[model samples]
Target: MPGEQQNTSELTVEELLHDAAVDSTDIEVFLNALTRLAVHNLSHPGEELLCGITLLRQKKASTVASSSDRAQKLDEIQYDYADGPCLKAAREQVLVHVPDLQEDARWPEYRETVLEEGVRSILGVPIAIGSGNAAGLNLYSDEKGRFDEEAVESAQQYARQASRALSLAVRLARHRDTEADLQAALESRTTVALAIGIIMGQNRCSHEEAFDLLKSASSSRNIKLRELAADLVASADPSSAGAHFDR
Candidate 1:
């Protein structure tokens, strides 16, 4: 099985990106699919394959995705103890391999807990995505010595593929978030403008005076200008404002 050349479909760089794009902003979906595909294509000798993508930001590491619930629980155990191969790989940006957790000496508590959970082998591959962010792909197996040199090498390649796709997904997710924020800002401005129109028509005031009056009202009520405008807009149009912006 080690030297067998299976003619599986080669995962191209473009295909990974396409998968990431298809998942939209769901990091869990993208990572779970990527890791499962990686394990299936590599044809490793293992009963089960599990993966977790960790995002390191603000000096904090969190498991963002996993291929299975067992994998997620194992990762959580490591996080609880602050010592495990996955957390180490993510925090230190290194490749971590444990051939047999029962005999491993690196993490005493973690090794004991994982062995009880029927996890015998693990591989952690660092995934760097875009700027100011890094993640790790964690693989778990039920068989001991499952992740040998060849498996590790194959996992590295998959991690590279995942990195490319995850980088794009991260950027796209940020873009979507930014776009949403800008849309909300613009909508708030429009609502305020509409409220200003109402104020001008009712109080016979100029544009500047109307805005000042709105601000004064907002300050007096201890509410945001946008919130005051939204309220005013809701009062002006009983149907549109609540239907569109209340969310």
Candidate 2:
């Protein structure tokens, strides 16, 4: 009963991500915070010197979203050589911690290549979103056996924060796109209305006839209706009665 109760209390990474309840501002803060945490955590004596975050696309695990040269190079190494902890963790959706590269033979090519770069240890943790595949947070250390279980757990917590932030960002981006489209539509309609009014005054025509005139002018001049409307508005003058019919 006690074991089952403890298991029930333990929350999965997905649950933790939802608990964060990310907003647009929170998304920015979360990303900045995660990067800061990674920097600080790696700054710990003997911890891996993190290059940057490398996001593994769910549709293609080999594809990576790396912001820097170092991270891109690391992703290339993992993909080309095929034996790094980052690759393993992302593929398996689990933590891969290598205490020392000198003695670790799990990935011979990777070990040789990474050690040549002055890295002695690596700790990779999977970054998952929802119920899908995972990406990786690859941490490199100059010292042997740098990340312990506690450090890995801390990294996992940060990954959870990142997931929530990403979800919120995507949602906000869609909303912004929709809002922009709607505003553009409204502005276009206003321009058309203004043009119609201008044509009515100038041609001494009905509203329907004015709109038809505006459309004919637009089609003849090969100008956007909105631009034509704006031009008509610019030509009209309030003080001169002839200004309305001038154009």
Give the best candidate by TM-score: 1
RMSD of each: 4.8, 6.8
lDDT tens digits by residue: candidate 2, 175-218: 77788899999988997788777667667888988887777777
- Scored by lDDT, model 1 comes in at 0.76
User: TM-score of model 2 relative to the true fold?
Assistant: 0.55
Prediction 2 global C-alpha lDDT: 0.65
Itemize residue pairs with steric clashes in candidate 1: none
The parts of candidate 1 lying over 4 Å away from their true place are 1-8, 12-17, 22-25, 43-46, 237-247
Best by lDDT: 1
Model 1 Cα displacement at 179 (Å)? 1.0
Worst 10 residues of 1 by lDDT: 238-247
Candidate 2 clash pair list? 48-140, 48-141, 99-145
Determine the backbone clash count of candidate 1. 0
